[model samples]
Target: MAKKKAVGQRGSWFATVDGIELPCAHRRWAKKNWPHYHDPFKPTENGPSASKILKYVQAIKDEKQVILTNDDEHLDDEGELTGFTRLNYIAIYGVENVSFDPDAGLKFTITKRLVELR
Candidate 1:
């Protein structure tokens, strides 16, 4: 089990959980395949879907049983969320579907799934 980093260190670099480490490879993948606008934190309809996000959330629950709730309800002037992507990076994979294994990453699938749901 990979121990959680002490706040804002390398955790910002890769996705780590239960001592398992999934690094920038995942983030880079999400960036390349995901839509140009899809941001995780401030998840907009333009970004990933609640279902896809739900997958990640489920994964986290499976691994550590942690719960992540949306704290912000306001969008930006242009209508963007606080940052992008919830659960942070290192801890993101725990959210589930953060990676797709082959083509496309979690964000892309989530964004697409969100569109389909809509």
Candidate 2:
């Protein structure tokens, strides 16, 4: 028989986004693929990005609901939030899709799998 991993021990970090909770690893995966976005010397800078993303998500959860897909518009054409910032957002808030409204603010679509049922 194979040994089973302890609950919460083997899984990646998770955060709540739009009432749904998801693993942070997914965002980390995206960031890992984009090496240039990260500061090689100061890796810890990426840590706070997650919290920022969560704050963004939490503020809009009631109106935006859930995150569904990834889009290029999530970041600026110059690539703000495209690398580590984007990764942190995805990991902490489950915001798969992002858009900006000049009059409003950042708009997002989130994952549904881990939604918290009322």
Candidate 3:
């Protein structure tokens, strides 16, 4: 059985399908719900895999520019491009928690603070 989230679990539940990410609800009050995305790697744990995290860490170590983009296809309210736009950023201070649903084959999100080169 899948482990349920903490008390009053209310958050975004996502899954990946053919490289496309799909979203749904999570932690029903009565039932155990989970995404149905088939994990090709068949990971033993629920997350983005070690290789994914290493990529970013390596970039930070090498002081390489990290590309930033919005997941949405529309322009964000903050003026950030919703689509792909080349934003070269250097000096990543640190990275936040990175996790995902293994059963759903979800694409994990990486949160990091970047120092933009002026």
Candidate 4:
């Protein structure tokens, strides 16, 4: 029998937009909750495409700033980080590039420009 593939064995993809290391999995919650902003990727299915993600990044970058926070902060009354809630606002920067690794998944790099921490 063929050896079974491990979970996330194929790894993931990451994109660095406006100096933020945005992992492909980072916006999972947004993908499900806010389809307008987040578009999930599933290489195995007809899911998000690279250009689509790039567009999203560009849109966010155009904002010139954004608020970011830990996914845990979106927990529901049941103490589960499921559903939508106010996202912690974090400073924004510039994009560098997006990378992929078969073992490590996706990796992103941010711009070298300095961004004030709020």
Candidate 5:
């Protein structure tokens, strides 16, 4: 796709996939809405969610299959398996009252969806 860039030595930006991961479209974000596209939400509970869209930018990539996992099993600080599942990341997009959408034609619903640049 976008030349795959130099595969970062690290896969998970947070070092580990223990929580809901919000990637910055890797650095390609600079060309898009940048913070607007990558930072739709501010993380309130942990941070604060975005209130309104300053600007809306169209998507660039074609592949819609997100890096999702049904097994949303997370690990606590002590490395113990937590029962809570962070599979639903729609909140990151400032979406409320959401429900899972498997159809690849819609926006980030309530299910686990990810994107992988090939």
Candidate 6:
């Protein structure tokens, strides 16, 4: 059975999905929400999986160019069509705090910060 309470402040609930405890806004929202799915491995809990659909993003900061990559697929917003075979680094960002819906496979978003090299 699902539990409901009006006490406390708004956005407060514990998720009990498949015997796994996850905190969320609505407790009942996870009930049979994801039909057949498994939680991804967290960086802290487990190392980044190589099979993930994530790539790298290259950028320069303070004359020191660096390549950063995360465990999530990302899009390039920059309008520069730089050569892909150049000797430059890359960067990557991930969509955080993603929630799953039974019918919906996976849903998440990513926000990137850009700094031009002058």
Clash pairs (backbone) in predicted model 6: 33-102, 57-90, 57-91, 58-89, 58-90, 58-91, 68-92
Superposed Cα deviation of residue 25, candidate 1 (Å): 20
Per-model lDDT: 0.34, 0.35, 0.29, 0.37, 0.26, 0.25
Worst 10 contiguous positions by lDDT, candidate 2: 35-44
The candidates, ranked best first by lDDT, are 4, 2, 1, 3, 5, 6
Q: Please write out the lDDT profile of model 6 over residues 1-118, one tens digit for every residue.
A: 2322212222212222234322222111222342222233223323333333122111111112121211122224774222122121122222343444333423333334222111
Q: Cα deviation in Å at residue 102, candidate 4?
A: 14
TM-score of each: 0.28, 0.20, 0.23, 0.30, 0.19, 0.19
Which ten residues in a row are the worst by lDDT in model 6?
56-65
What is the per-residue lDDT of model 2 for residues 56-84, given as tens digits with 9 covering 90 to 100?
44544433333222223335487555432
TM-score of structure candidate 1 = 0.28
RMSD, one per candidate, in order: 13.2, 14.7, 17.6, 16.0, 13.6, 20.5
Estimate, for each residue in 6-71, the C-alpha lDDT of model 4 and write its tens digit.
121122333344455432234443334432223223253444566755654554444432333223
Among the numbered candidates, top TM-score falls to: 4
Better of 1 and 2 by lDDT: 2
> Candidate 3: what lDDT?
0.29
The list of candidate 6 runs beyond 4 A from truth reads 1-91, 113-118
Overall local distance difference test of candidate 6: 0.25
lDDT, candidate 2, residue 45?
48
Report the lDDT tens digits of candidate 3 across residue range 1-118: 2221211112222222234232321111102222221212334344444666444344433432222221222355986333322222222223222234434332322244333222
Best by lDDT: 4
> Which pairs of residues have clashing backbones in candidate 3?
none
Output the TM-score of candidate 2. 0.20
